[model samples]
Target chain A: SQTIHQWPATLVQPVGSPLSLECTVEGTSNPNLYWYRQAAGRGLQLLFYSVGIGQISSEVPQNLSASRPQDRQFILSSKKLLLSDSGFYLCAWGGPDYGYTFGSGTRLTVV
Target chain B: QKEVEQDPGPLSVPEGAIVSLNCTYSNSAFQYFMWYRQYSRKGPELLMYTYSSGNKEDGRFTAQVDKSSKYISLFIRDSQPSDSATYLCAMSVYAGGTSYGKLTFGQGTILTVHP
Candidate 1:
């Protein structure tokens, strides 16, 4: 079975602080990985997606960036956080059948 | 206008009642439609998906897509409290180059089925 993992599960960070959120997949190879942000009523917005290592496609232009260091490991980062950057962050892996399998998500509160 | 539009209903229904959730889209190129169920503070789960137009059913969930009207719907039969969650409507084209299989989502409708 394939599973996606994301952490820290929850975080409280101060403004201008650096941020790092990690996501990983198991039981699949060369799968498509994506970063999404879900706000209260805006639904899920695509942030970044990667087809392979070092191949990152950004969907939204903001303070956040993404990297694929390893085949199954994707990292979302920011040098300086903004108040608007607070939301639920989700990681997903795609397949032809089910569309996407999402991680539990990371709730980041920027104060 | 937003490519996809869904009524963000904080809908409350009694157990065993039928629930209907819906979304509309402006993109005629969109070929795949999906429904996802999301619990509070958790990620959304894929409930059902249909290609192009027509209906697909699984268990108590039925998904309908009308490409001509640019509308799609999700129907929950014998709705239970366990079925209470936010339902999101998503769609995508057949391919998107490097961004293939990406989905565009509606604002989502929140549902609560009480006893």
Candidate 2:
């Protein structure tokens, strides 16, 4: 079985602080990884996706960036956080099929 | 216009009643359609997936898609309180090149099933 892990489960940071959120996948190799932000009603918005190591495609331009350091490890980072950057961050791995398997998610609160 | 459109309903329904959710899309290139359920403050979970235009059924859920109409639906039978959550519709083009497995999601519909 394949599983995705994301952390710090929840975070509260002051505005302008640096941010790092990590996601990893187990039981699969060379899997497609994606980062999404879930707002209250806007649904899941794709932020970044990687097909392989060192390759990242951004869907929306924002204060965040993504990196794939290892085959199964993806990190979402920001040099400085903005108040609008607060939301539920989800990490997902694409399956052999069409759909995706998502992690528990990270609730980031930038105050 | 948005690529995908879904009613953000805080729909209230009694237990055992049938629940129907729907979404419309403006893009005709979408070949893979999916429905996901999300609990409060949690990540969305895949509930149903369909290819092109057709109907697929699981234990208690059914998914329908109409390519010509560019519409998709998810129906939950014998709704339970546990089913109370937000339902989101997502679609993607075929895997390859830049569009590989990238999904476009709707605004999601919130459903509350009461016991």
Candidate 3:
């Protein structure tokens, strides 16, 4: 079985602060990874996706970025956070069946 | 219009009642369909997945896909309060090139089953 772990379950940062969220998948290799954000009462919005190491695709232009340093490790980062960056951030891995296994998510609050 | 459309309903139903959720898509190449259940303030969980056109049943939940009509549906039988959550419909073309597993999701419908 495969499991995903994301850290700092909840984060509170001031505007212009740096942000980093990590996601690692156990028991899977070369999987498709994705970063998504959900605003209150809104649907999940795709932010970035990576097919392999050093390959990232941005779905929307924003102040956020994503990277896959390792095959099973994905990281979402921001040099300077903005108020609009606050939301529920989710990291997901695409399985062999093409089903997505999502992490518990990181709630970012920029105050 | 959005590539996919779903009713954002805060639908309420009693226990043991049947629940139905639906989505429509404009992409004709979508061959994979999925339904995800999300608890409040939590990540979405995979509830059911279907390929092409057909109906697949898993215990109390059934997923139906109509490729011709570009529609998909999820039915929950014997609904429970635990089943109360938002249901999202996602679709994708096959895995290849830039389209591989790049899912486009619907707005999601909120379902609440009362005990």
Candidate 4:
């Protein structure tokens, strides 16, 4: 079975501080990875998606960026955090065969 | 106009009652529809998926898609308190290259089933 893991289930960062969130998948290879942020009532917004290592397509223009360092490891980072950057961050993996699976998510609070 | 629209219902129902959640879309190119359940402070979980116009049922959950009307629905039979979660509707175009596997979601409908 395929599973996704996201770190720092809860995070509290000061404004203008650097931020990093990591996600990884197991039991699959060359699967597509995605980063999504969920805000209260705004729905799930796609932040970035990667088809392969180093191939990232961003869906929104913001302070956040994503990277795929390995086949199953995806990272989300920001040089400086904004108050609006606080939200629920979810990582998901999908493919033609592997439907879609989401991680537990990281609740980031920027003060 | 948004590509997808869903009523963000804070709907409350008694146990064993039937629950209906719906979403409407303006994009005719979308052919895949899905329903997801998200608990408070948790990630959304896929509950049902449909390829096109038709109905698909599994256990107590039924998913209906009407492409002609660009509408989709998720029906929960004998709803339980455990079903108290936000339901999200998502859609994507088939074989959308580069954009493949990308999903557009609607603002979720929050549901609460009291015991």
Candidate 5:
């Protein structure tokens, strides 16, 4: 079985502070990884997706960026946080057969 | 028009009643359909998935896809309080290139099952 781990279930950051959220998947290799953000009332929006290591695609332009440093490790980072950056961030891994397996998610609040 | 549209229903239903959640899409290229359930402050879990059209049943949950209408549905029989959550509909294309495995999700519908 595969499992995804996301750290810092809840985070509060000061405005203009740096942000880093990490997600790692175990028991799978070369899986497609995705980053999504869900705002209040709005649907889950795709932020970034990676097909392989060092390959990332941005779905929406924003302050956040994603990186696939390792095959099973994905990281979402921002040099400076904005008030609008606050939302529920989700990490997911999937394949061609089974659908995506999402992590517990990181709730970010920029104050 | 939105690629995928779902009613954001804060629907309330009694226990043991049948629950129906639906989503409609404007994209006809979608070949893979899925339904996800999310609890409060939790990640969405893939509850059911169907390829193309027709009906697929697993235990108490039934997933229906009508490609002609570009609509998909999820039916929960004998609903319980635990089943109260937000349901999201997602779909993707079958092409092996960039579009493959990329899912576009609906806004999600909230359902509350009272005990």
Candidate 6:
């Protein structure tokens, strides 16, 4: 069975501080990975998606960026955080059945 | 219009009742449909998926897709309190092997099953 994991399940960062969130998947290779953010009580907003190692497509323009350093490792980073950057961050990977598997998510609070 | 549209419903129902959630889309390229469930403060979980059109059932859940109408639905029979969560509808094109799973989602509908 495949599983996805995300780090720093919760975090609070000061405004203008750097941000880094990590995600890793096990039991799968070269799967598509995605980063999504959900504001309070709102729907998900796709931020970025990676098709393969070192290849990323950003869905929305913002302060955040994503990288796929390995076949199953994805990272979301920001040089400086904004108040609007606070939200629930989710990492998802495509499945063999054309479905998606999401991680536990990280609750980021930017003050 | 958005590519996909779903009612942001706070639909409430009693336990054991049947629950129906729906979404409509304007895109004709969508050949794959899916439903996802998300608990409060949690990531969305894949519940059901259907391709092309017609009905697909798995246990207590059934998924329906109408390609001509560009609509899809998810039905939960014998709804339980554990089923209370937000349901999101997503669709994608069948772009052959590698491009098959890039999904576009609609705003989710909130479902609450009371005990």
Model 2 per-residue lDDT tens digits across residues A13-86? 99999999999999999989999998767888999999899999999889999999999999999999999999
Residue pair clashes in candidate 5: none
Q: TM-score for model 2?
A: 0.97
- Candidate 4: residue A68 Cα off by (Å): 0.5
RMSD of each: 1.3, 1.3, 1.4, 1.3, 1.2, 1.4
- lDDT of each residue in B1-115, candidate 1, tens digit only: 9999999988999999999999999999888899999998999999997988899999999999999999999999999999989999999876645546778999999999999
Report the C-alpha lDDT of model 6 over A2-61, residue by residue, as the tens digit.
999998899999999999999999998888899989888677888998889999999889
**Which regions of candidate 5 fall more than 4 Å away from where they truly are?**
B97-99
DockQ of each: 0.64, 0.59, 0.55, 0.57, 0.61, 0.55
> Candidate 2 falls in which docking quality class?
medium
Model 3: lDDT of residue B113: 91
Report every candidate's CA lDDT: 0.92, 0.92, 0.91, 0.91, 0.92, 0.90
TM-scores for every predicted model: 0.97, 0.97, 0.96, 0.97, 0.97, 0.96
Q: Please give the TM-score of chain B in predicted model 1.
A: 0.95
- How high is the lDDT of residue B80 in model 3? 92
Residue A84 lDDT (model 6):
98
Docking class of 3: medium
Tell me the lDDT of candidate 5: 0.92
Model 4, position B80: C-alpha lDDT score: 96
Q: Which tens-of-lDDT digit does each residue in B53-94 have in candidate 2?
A: 999999999999999999999999999999999999999888
Give each candidate's interface RMSD in Å: 2.1, 2.4, 2.4, 2.4, 2.1, 2.2
Residue A46 of model 6 has an lDDT of 82
